[model samples]
Target: MLPINFYGKPTIGGVIGFLFLFTAFMRKKTYTKKTKGLFIKQRPEKKCFKCQGFGIIRCDLCSGKGFVFYERKYQRSDPCPKCFQKRYDMCPFCQGNGERSFLGKTGSNKYNKKIFRIFE
Candidate 1:
């Protein structure tokens, strides 16, 4: 007994009743537990006062842990065939762990004359 058209539209049942009321008002709201602060606090590990924490030292000429088998005697010819002496090889100039920055030689020529008077 369905014969409605125009004003009383039945155009395919009004597009399936507006797609079932737009899929029941498109739902998706439901979530809780709002209190974010992750919890992160960790920073404390800096101890290297000239290899005090044993980072590396003692090698002041094979003292740390290298090699140093000594015995010398150059009487005349070919006796000095690199016997074995080695001294402060790595620590020549903070190359080891002296921490550098001795700033000698008049403090780097007074810091290059104050950077050439601040670039002239």
Candidate 2:
């Protein structure tokens, strides 16, 4: 039998305190109440300067035809060499989404607005 103050065995009050602390630490830290989906944590997506938020653009190589014609003295039509017959490829800059995210604000005050994950 040990004394009441035995450090090896935790008291009821100590256990409660520990549980409270653990729960507090497990919570997510945010500036406001979170209603975001459990799987997706969406962020601010700005319009891609190149695609202009259209999610697509005319194929520069094939002129949006998805294929090309060999124009050397009227050669036969063939798949576009650039897009590999797909006519449109994912934009390298915005990955075909035509939108991007701004993590930090720029010189303009309007950019200071934050986009939370709840809008979607």
Candidate 3:
């Protein structure tokens, strides 16, 4: 018999136990003949308000210079204080994806009619 390692990995015993659990759980699931699957409707994409869809905005630390100097006498260029090395980093609000979307309620399908009824 294989030993069960709970946190890290699946042992033979763990797999068997999980299969038994999943089967037991699935047995309790009831499906109605009129039930329909949930639908994921596409939402219109909008530009990220933070970056204005640019995926980046000016780095406030270096004043958009993309670099800074350690000492005026040394006269050397270093990575921007804010952007690290790049002139710009991904917009914090949009996470650099440059788009936004959201889920909305459209009426429920046959399956979720009961679920949606609760919201109303």
Global Cα RMSD, each model: 24.2, 12.5, 17.5
Off by over 4 Å in 2: 1-45, 101-120
In the range 1-120, model 1's lDDT, one tens digit per residue, is 334366865678667776766776775433232457553322114333454322234545445334544556633322222223332233232333334334311234666577668989
- Model 2 Cα lDDT, one tens digit per residue, 40-81: 333225776666665556778889897786767667887888
Candidate number achieving the greatest lDDT relative to the actual structure: 3
Better of 2 and 3 by TM-score: 2
Query: In model 1, what lDDT does residue 10 have?
Result: 67
Tens digits of lDDT, candidate 3, 2-108: 46686888787778987887798888443323326754322225876667766578887887887886776667878776788677777765566566523222334
Error of model 3, residue 95, in angstroms = 0.7
The residue pairs that clash in candidate 2, if any, are 46-100
Candidate 2 residue 41 Cα shift, in angstroms, is 17
**True lDDT of residue 85, candidate 2:** 71
Local error of candidate 3 at residue 13 (angstroms) = 43
> TM-scores of all models?
0.18, 0.40, 0.38
Candidate 3 residue pairs that clash: none
lDDT comparing candidate 1 with the true structure: 0.43
Supply candidate 1's per-residue lDDT for 28.
43
After superposition, candidate 1 runs with Cα above 4 Å error = 1-44, 52-54, 63-65, 69-71, 74-120
Candidate scoring better on lDDT of 1 and 3: 3
